[model samples]
Target: MQTRSLWEHTLTFFPQFLAALKEHAPRDATVAVIGASDGKFVLPLAAAGYRVIAVERDPLALHGGEVHLPGTAHAHATGLIDRLRLEDLYDRVQVVEQDFLGSEPLDRLCDAVWTSCSWHYSVNHRRPLAEFVARMQLLVRADGLFGAEFMMPVEARHHLVDHYTSPEKLSRHFTGAWNVLLTLRTAEFTERAHHGRLQDHTHRMGLLLAARTSDHPHPHGKKNA
Candidate 1:
């Protein structure tokens, strides 16, 4: 049986990032996905022959279980592991079940790193946005790709939080040894009701793709004089 994610059809800018990775990184590059929910992006990367590091803390999303549907109903869901196993791609992935910020640094640098609207959740708001970006940056090797598509402010409350930010605002985190490749933002648009969103809603999203330059300095941004 084919498996699907709750966000199967959600709008995303990940394709642009993947294309960029293909052009810049090697065919067997190792990738680290920060919010790899049920393998939305992970599966495709693994299918394309890229080694993947899937970082997610939600048990239901990573391990599979019952999930509430639109109405008063629930259904069995296929988690990341099951989907990978079924596709014969389990050997290409490493699952890290932990809060990214709380977890220790990744063991080794990756050729590319990507995250999608992961840090905007309330639970992550406690940590500064810079911290999240810096951590992701730290995981990429020199000349590696770093991609992120994030939520832009839509509601009054969203404006109050730094997480609901535009691509321009997020770009401030990259400098010195980093080169901004592309940045995109979508105007507020309506989206069909999904799992957490029970009613039609409007949202603005942004994407930022950058590369750690070949002469990349320390992750902390200190360069040789």
Candidate 2:
């Protein structure tokens, strides 16, 4: 399956994602979601009464409106927003179609910054990870939160997988910028033969979740001197 299709599959279990979200975000907190594919994460936040801004890099996908998940055809992200008659809910959300790395700074501080399954494709993974954590540190107020869910490897070798980052390497990248809240690895199962074949050849089936420390200094507007 394509990356888009994989994301669609993942969005079906909103409850799983929500459980994690609640652990990190408070009620009525402001949130910024980067690389928000079809808006799956954004819709839930809207429903839960949190202010959300979802940014996507693919204009075609956004304009295409909604993409139903495979098997169940469940609406996700933009579709969920529309199905729930929550377009007005967008008053609280700001969905933008632009490269997350190249986008302008957000207008206000958020309670949390979330990047679910979106950081692996970053052009310069290390620099962007640093910049992303630093940016989130600036976007989230002191005592606020920053979280990410990444596709990582159990071992340090790059498989035939599309993208893979080692947990240890990722931890080193965030060293002082964020606290390691949770790092759980879950197996990814595939019913399709090709997917299973790919998985067999490539060890591409693990997830990682990490949270940013609250005390980190905001990297906003600091002189480079």
Candidate 3:
């Protein structure tokens, strides 16, 4: 999906997202964005004065996808960054291609972890639900912000988002160790397949912002040791 469309259809509360990062994450902290396909969100974020590290598994995400972005044929990930001169920004947005479910974990912890519409993939590919939480714990530290936007019926995280979406149900996951900050159940959308596509689709969505509690058990951000 095009980044612009993703922003319009799903990411409605950009303000809350900013607040989460500013309040929970440290100043000049690095933001690790899961599913950072083609710097769609990364470029704007980097320009906003935060260091960004985009992680994507799709090979095309690094370069460009099969379908070029509007107004250009070489509208790949890195190409967009270079074109917009976002490359001049410090910390130089970095995009890494790796499976989030692989045996290896990230080498470093982040001040904020941004996973937009990508959590379902972890649930589908990775085994137990606890494993998914454990992985996040290791990658994110106490007081760090964890943001997500996904479809409803995340109880199993098995399939992709289609019609089932309940913010009330999804908000339950942010309790206990996590402090649920913002849970806005935005309007349902009939999104399109892609740029210039007339195919409309309906999806249930939940936007969320949560922070790991200070007494969140694990000191180093990993549990079940």
Candidate 4:
């Protein structure tokens, strides 16, 4: 399968973006990576010594390495984990191949939550954004960090169109639950072979960072102090 140029660009920038988030994160903090897709962000975080739980939906996407198409890269959470040579880290790192909106229990409270362009495509976009933010907030301790990158243009003719959200819309989603730290919009250009004609287009990429507003009941019944 052919890989989209946009996905390539995203992969290139992910390391730096994640590193920035890590730099600001507390040392040895618990982290949860949603839409982990091959553990690209998970492995590096593990190598950095943070307790991490990676959630993804497709098991094959995690294990099928270079054999899978770029569109499937983020769909598979296991691929990146296996590639990092840190499989034994699973003891400290958990990989859950399931939908994020489902009722599965993610029992650990975390200091950081990382999601790379995955929230917009969840099965329950219509569900109250507050509820979703509340769920994530509960997973993170007071003063913990949350970071995500979202696609701004839903009109982009790509396989991930179903998962894209505009900056304006996402901002409102986080308004009450967290403080917005950063919103960076970068313009990207791509040429697609459509109908045997190369069509060049540009789209916006948005990166967002927020901090959980207040302390919530940690699953372990211990307060974040």
**TM-score of every model versus the real structure:** 0.95, 0.67, 0.73, 0.70
lDDT of 1 by residue, 1-225 (tens): 267778897899999999999998999999999989899999999999999999999998898898776774778889999998998999999999999999897878888999999999998988999999999998888888999999999999999999999888998998898999999999999988777787788989999999999885555543211
- Candidate with the larger TM-score of 3 and 4: 3
TM-score-based ranking, best first? 1, 3, 4, 2
Candidate 1 Cα misplacement greater than 4 A, ranges: 220-225
* lDDT by candidate, in order shown: 0.90, 0.57, 0.61, 0.61
What digit string (tens of lDDT, one per residue) describes model 2 on residues 1-225? Answer: 111322343323334445666777677777778876656577667768988877777753455443444344444333323422444565767776677667776767777777765666646364545666555556666555656666655454544343465555556655665665555554654334221132233233333344556567655633211
lDDT tens digits, residues 1-225, model 4?
A: 112222333323355446755666677777888877766567767767888888878565466533433334333323544644445555667777777777654766678887776665546466654565556656667667877776566363544443465555567766555677766767765534221123445455677677766654344544442
Full-model lDDT, candidate 2:
0.57
- The candidate, 1 or 3, that scores higher on lDDT is 1
Backbone clashes, each candidate? 0, 4, 1, 7
Expressed as tens digits, the lDDT of each residue in 75-191 for candidate 3 is 333433332353565356666668776648777777777766665553444465345545655666677777767665533442444223455655555666788777876565666
Sort by lDDT, best first. 1, 4, 3, 2
Model 2 compared with the native: what TM-score?
A: 0.67
After the best TM-score superposition of candidate 4, give how far the Cα of residue 19 lies from its true spot, in angstroms: 4.9
Q: Return whichever of 1 and 4 wins on lDDT.
A: 1
Error of 4 at 216 (Å): 7.4
